[model samples]
Target: MNGIRAFGATPSDLALDPFDEGTSSYSKAKDTSPIARLQERIDRGETKLSHDAQFGYLLSLMEELGVSTHSQLLVFSKTSLQRERITPKTPRALYFNDDVYLGFIPGAPFIEVSGMDSKLGGVFYSIDQGKTGRPRFVRTDQCLECHTSTKTLGVPGPLVRSFITDADGVVDMASGTSLVNHRTPLSERWGGWYVTGTHGAQTHRGNLSGREAFALHEKEPNHLGNQMDLRRFFDVSRYPAATSDIVALMTLEHQAHMQNFLTRLNQDSTSALRQFGHLNMKK
Candidate 1:
């Protein structure tokens, strides 16, 4: 099969301005997002976080948000901004709720996060995992490079990328790629995640590694089984949870795509309101 060219070959990708704060809603009111409010809670001692290890802070945040450790899902793909820390053996752990997504890489300096805003749809943030002073929740704009693009319909949003990966978790774009969502077929899902649930006899592209790029097989949902033990993959002690529950992965896929749609809607309404004001002033 012909290897598809790089994603950056497209004109829109070449023209992408990730730091163009001029148009992003985040640049305008980042300080008002839910993440920002969470920081305020920290300041008031309403939410306490340990300034020690990343896990401590992660655990605290999860507790505050009602996210269970049981909801853990591991992704070995280098599909995030902190690609350097991802690998097949040490996958990034993801936890989510109806309104937020929390990402933690084993040895990364910070935890990548996003929370839904009533106005902005999805707001990006990074909490310093190594902070000695007050833990800083910095609003990040770099995420827009991937979150705001044709893939997301040109707004800040969540997206899931499915592709064949090498041993180190680097995607082999030449093989193939799929923009996954809840609607995506189960067989075409979870290319680089460790799914730990039984789905009858169904099979998926999870929990496998090879020396070279290889296409995923057609996995019947019945072949997949619910797995609660993940000690075989890595030391379960290092993480807060052991199971990479398949149910959580399925929920993540659904919410991620929904978040993208919400973001675009927010941006559209904001733009339209501005246009209406300009036309009214002319009358």
Candidate 2:
């Protein structure tokens, strides 16, 4: 419950420069991510990605990266970098494996992607969906603005957030948002998302896409609980899967932060060893 990040009360957090070349070297590090590896294969002509008329480059990219289509999860919150086109009717689809997360907006020009780096924690990239001879995953820095924060353990990492959203998928700032992980209670999870499955009595904030639903959550929180189908929320035909699985969502929430924790530990240990020299502890 108490930590250096909670209030910045300790100078310890400032001890390591995450971007320093000699330390973590987040920006300078040659990230050995799966996306980067796949890109190399394409550049060397060792492999080529398929682009389809129906799904664009989605299926091919997923195949190249080894991400399962069944791991798809839907988030309707308008808190994305590409928020202008996202809505409850056009929620963002995220498919992931243990090492990577790929985000797709139905009509967007490109697919957003992030993958784990042994040194950089999370490396962000994008793949264009338009017709082209060769597709490339361009690494970007803009994603770091939000991806690196106390919530991500001061590392460039992925996050699964929960917020109070309105009908058009706009988040209500007054309602406050939460950085979710496994530590988060089940009842408080999944706002601004569509979760399809059946839970007899348990409740979450998923499938509530109205201002009134947020307020009603104070009383009848389960007003939208246990939705076995998502046909009414959006066109199920538009996405890879009709169901935004609860198991996948929960696993994603936990995995995202577990990566951050690993990065934090790696960063701090590297920095501390360099700064204070080796420990002479009493074994």
Candidate 3:
């Protein structure tokens, strides 16, 4: 049984391996604004790259709100021995702790905020049947109250949580050690307690429940590696893309990244100065 590790609070702590190393620049702008100060550090190799965990978190949040899909293209086998079939997979939610693309762009700021037209902002579709439509946006201020807490608070809400399964027919998390190990036999493999089987994967042994696995982590809050319960800020009940609501969620995320970057910069500067003065005295 290849046990799954839970998602880490920090980017360096993801379960899935890192993405391919050499992709072209995704952003196309220069950084001449105040945010450029951070960009210079990145260019000079003074800062580390942000982790995929951030992007994954954003993708998951989008999916929960019905913003993105698993598979954009359907795969079909055309061999004579096999009948035609289509398989689809969607991407996980994505989050960002910094303005990563600014490094490659000559003058882009560390934080870029483009105003997306309201009409194109929130969009959703029915996972049940690929039905297309829009959902109403109700501001979830109550949800953000806890999610936006600082790290020292011990409950900095997560941006995403991808689910997986374990050997005992239990749903395990990649970020933590929570398990939704129900004993119904048939229903044991259901995802997120929905029993929809949409989020389960069938392995050599049995079906691995993705949603159940995620729920397990949520259930075990204090589990050694468990960080925060992401379900708190997500209003899954609203279907089809909760555009306005999701926009607000992303906005908060943007602020969070700015805060994180400033904190790190301060620490790095202090350490650098301390080391530099020490070297001078030694000489």
Candidate 4:
């Protein structure tokens, strides 16, 4: 049996052997992005990171990558594949720019990252907690298991989802899944996210959850606004910023879709190139 079903096999078992250094664009591509190139520098003891109480590296990386704090969006629901660290009180904050999305979960072992590559589409990395010198950013293959699925257009990419969650932040998967994009109706968006902007009389599934199946109404007003304080949920000061602006959430939705499109296009072009090369070899 391959690594997928092998009992004691680790997640990297398959990705390490034949494909790790050969076929995987993530491992082969050199001139990709700043984050992609950092791995080699880290291996060469060239990159040094300073520590912070609540992940100072995340902020420093954002600054280095030109990601703005104004791009903050918080998801309080346990919608993450890494559901253990996510909760209503300790929500996960997502920050992004044109080419990258950074996921920071307080008290978690690693900070998640997904970068858009011109050729590889999406490349995932995790900066783990290393008590020694600088913390190392390790390239991970596990993210592709979910990120490269049908939801991401059959290529490694990003996605945004909303879920019906309980008070403890556990998602009600039995209630089914809802994926949101720019074209999705406003009322149907942000089911598990915390919106912090004025939408006037607009209502969404955000900022509300219960044990029972509660129906969402169209006319019901969403009281969550810019003045709402998230400090009540958790110590907001632990982060670089506090507010999870609604405008940021909207932008995230749009970016996720566009990233998927770019990823699919890249995959197609890569396959075409390989096919042309094989054809030429026959002559």
| Top model number, TM-score | 2
| Each model's lDDT | 0.70, 0.82, 0.24, 0.68
Tell me each candidate's TM-score.
0.81, 0.90, 0.21, 0.79
The sequence of per-residue lDDT tens digits that candidate 4 reaches over residues 95-211 is: 998888899887787888878877666788888743446666677778877776556555567887777788778877665346677877787777677777677776666765554
lDDT for each residue of candidate 1 in 1-283, tens digit (9 for 90 to 100)? 1112222233234233332453353677654556777788888988677644547478878877777887788889888888888998889998888887789887788888887876665678898777556777788878877877766645566777777677788887764445777777776777777878777656567765554324233333333235557777677777888878878888888887777666555555555566565776888
Cα lDDT tens digits for candidate 3, 181-259: 1112322222211111121222111112344533554565222121122223233222222121222223433443433
Best first by TM-score, ranked: 2, 1, 4, 3
Q: In order, how many clashes per candidate?
A: 14, 0, 34, 0
Tens digits of lDDT, candidate 2, 19-60:
545566667668799988998899999989998876779998
Local error of candidate 1 at 254, Å? 0.9
Worst 10 residues of 2 by lDDT: 1-10
Q: Which stretches of candidate 4 lie over 4 Å from their true place?
A: 1-31, 40-47, 212-219, 223-227, 270-283
Local error of candidate 3 at 120, Å?
Answer: 38
> Model 1 TM-score?
0.81
TM-score of candidate 3 relative to the true fold:
0.21
lDDT for model 4: 0.68
lDDT (0-100) at residue 272 of candidate 1?
58
Candidate 1, residue 9: Cα displacement in angstroms equals: 23
